[model samples]
Target: MRFSMHSTLFDPDALPFRRALIAGIACVAAVVAGAMLADQPYLIFAGLAGLVYVGTLTVNCRALAWLVIALQPAALIVPFFPGRPFWWELCALLAWPSLLAYGLVNRRKIEVVAFDRAERWALAALGGYVAVILGTMAYRGVGLRIFGGEQMGGRVYVQQLVLSILPVLMLLAGFSQKQLRMAMITGWLLSLTYIVSELTFARSQDMAPLLYFFELPVDGLNFSTGYDASGVRRFGSLAAVAGAGLSLLWVAAPLRELLGRWLLVTGPLMVALVGLGLGSGYRNVFASAICTLFFLAWVQRFWNPSRVISMVLVGAVMVGGLYFFAKELPLSVQRSVSFFPGIAISPIAKADAATTNSDRVEVLKLAIADSPKYWLFGRGFGMDRFDRLPVDDPNDSVSMLYSQGMFYNGFLGTLLKLGVFGLLCSLLFVWHVSKIALQLGLLVRRRTPSEWSFFDRVCLLLCAQWFAAVLLFYLTNGDVTWWMQSFGLLAGLLMACRRLKQDEGFVVDSDGVPKASVTA
Candidate 1:
């Protein structure tokens, strides 16, 4: 046999490949049985989901896995208009059965990567938190109703657990270093696309229709030309802004030296897109993005003596330029910056900003007030706003009014729902992941520029972004576990990569092929 480097990348005869194939076949058999017996039309959706996931697992293509992961943000952000199912949930939900089947069949092929001390502690904390939630639910009874209002049985509890755990398990079992790199690239590209689309369509008369078609929020319609009713267009709302900010951190990090020279041209374009996207009304997103950049720079040692002068000059120019041109800047952009700690703006704008800021403060206050009542276990996990809202409500305004309640300050909500103990565990989990990301960043920074491969560098950046994304999301939006789970999956894969040392273990290369050095 020839010793072509690429040849080992896709060895179908490999045990993992064969095991994945067998599991897929079993899934197909089940789908066929379901169709024959149940005769439900939705079985087709299930079949499609199963087949695609089976193919991805068996093929072990890093590109395919990343394509799916990259689309996750869009799936979450994109609207699920009237009569449409939230495809993001559907996509995530349908993927689990096939992945579990593959995992069981390939159980022996699965390498149980040992968690380091910090990771072990993190996992233990998370497990304990979940146990507390479940215990409290069991004792008080689980329900769609808050606290002791109504006991709806264990259906919601079980569903929340499944939803939360499925993605984490999939990432742990399915992803590799190569997929992580591709996910970073895809995430960046998608974020760029989102900003470009938002900017390009901001002034269009048909903006609402276009956004509706894509299931994006139309942002209000009462504002000025090109502005949403809130006087800003939050293309993907805070999520989109947060995603872009994370992407920007990657673009600005000291890691740029490791990326290809081509990024020199592409890099500025990305920065511009992101900068323009963080307009007025996106204070939280903007703050998160700025804080993350500072964090990345500090960790990467962006303040080395050699670069101090350049850093100061650049900072001066950015602040000065914006200050000088503040009036001429896009209203949205100006409004975005107006709420910064010491920015000055018109009295009306200032009042508007004050009102907006107070909403969050009030929500936090409300959460704090409610926390003491159920401080031990917190409100039950996965309390959906839709479940609380009447399905028969004729008031079109009800959805808008209650939707915000769905995610009210996610960080505070977590504290209120899970109690201080659960919140501490959640923070511990985040700390562990952040520690790993910081380690990766420091390692990458110390690497001789030429020694760092495309795969390694991108993986590091993505892990960092994933860490930042979760932190920003947790502190602000706090919703379902999907986004957090995505980051956790990234963290898990990054940890695996670190421990396995791709060149040593039975690891696949950047091309998704098994390395020749890895023997059975």
Candidate 2:
């Protein structure tokens, strides 16, 4: 192989990739899976990375994946404590510069025209975001309060912004095919492995595994009990399922036909879905599947009508078949079974057949009225509207709009962050990206060799995933683990994918790929 200087960067023999990641895994197993350590700093970083990419870690993504996996035990343990305050400081400070450096280096390797319009809009949009976020945070800082022993929480919040949001802007600066593939490979492999391992452990314990509507090896799960104090029937690992489920759906359209091409591709995922899907009891997962399937249908708009019709028909038949299955359960279990074929349209119910989302609706109403003269500009970035941020009558336009009105630069602040003309631009950018993924997904046949930008696919898929997740969160108000780590990860992945390459995927090879060597 001709050794271009850059070849070394991609070579598997050079960088200490495996060792670093193994060390990370060791940290996780020791810290998270086993016992509480005094506080390994790596555990915090690993958790943040895992949070940012619970779905994308694999040997190929980067050393970070191994680092995160090594730290997985800690990730499982993350909820036990408030993470130390300064975890993301490194990621925050390096955000934009690294993207710019890499983008500039690889600028000649890409077709920049795709993002020409998007870049122009985002640049203007970010200018506004800066003004609004800084201004709002500054203003709200006075009234914002942190929990006891958590006075440093604000710093953590801003640092998180850097780790997640800043990477987004940086990746957007270079929306290349190379980077996108990396993201996809990384997201798919790592997340899948984690799920498998977690499931294996859950089964070994004879515990109730919740994330799927399908089955896994749970020894002692009370299928008959709909609700338990521990929120029974909801898969335990699904705590991270939000990211995994959404990411999988992002690529669903493209992977849809590919699945049919070979049992190797289609059979495993289907079996996996059936085995894992019903166990979780997450309505968002259910809704994501429905919406993603529809989105893929829309993506395959030009495919043979017979194919599309067959899919729809098969889906209907399968769903209908499940209704009979639901009733076949012991009468006690059947009484608790109210998902899919039953409440397919609305996501308000749970495995126990009860509504669980009314609470988010109630909590979002706390912030009200267009108070600040700058209501149009919004309270600014990083403003926790949990204080008093509702901007309009509760009767008007759902909680997201209401919450955005009160805090997030309001409509004006939204404009400022996205620019007066750029909010739609950003929205369009998101929609446009999703559409591209759908198109590529539709065309991607198994083993046929997809020509779409690998990095772009990852970026686009992740964007779609986050778009769905954010949409669900905004629409229904799913809190708790929704934001804990996944939110930051999705945002960062979106940014990273936005700047991928043509053929080089995100996988870290057995070959040594160099570290982040570009001088920031």
What are the RMSD figures for all models against the true structure? 10.3, 13.2
lDDT of 2 by residue, 246-361 (tens): 44544544554544565366645653453355455544445665555454434333346777686678667766765756544333223223544443322223433442334334
Candidate 1 lDDT by residue in tens digits, 1-520 = 7665434435686666677788998888876867675576565665676667766663333333344457645523334333333343344454456456656766665446434565566567667666766775765555554344544434445544544443244444446556565665665556444444454355566564545434333242223343433344334443464555546446443443412354466446544655655553555556665565556555544456656675577567767766776666555566667765666555545555666566556545555555677567666644444353333552443343333343455566566556677677777777776665665554455455456566554545555556566766776666433334545446555555554344344344332233343457
Error of 1 at 398 (Å): 15
Kindly report which residue stretches of model 2 are placed more than 4 angstroms away from their true locations once superposed: 1-115, 142-156, 164-183, 192-231, 239-268, 271-275, 300-303, 327-353, 357-474, 477-520
lDDT of each: 0.53, 0.41
TM-score of each: 0.67, 0.52
The reply for model 1, stretches above 4 Å from the true place, is: 1-68, 76-88, 133-163, 166-177, 192-213, 217-234, 237-271, 346-348, 381-411, 442-446, 466-486, 496-520
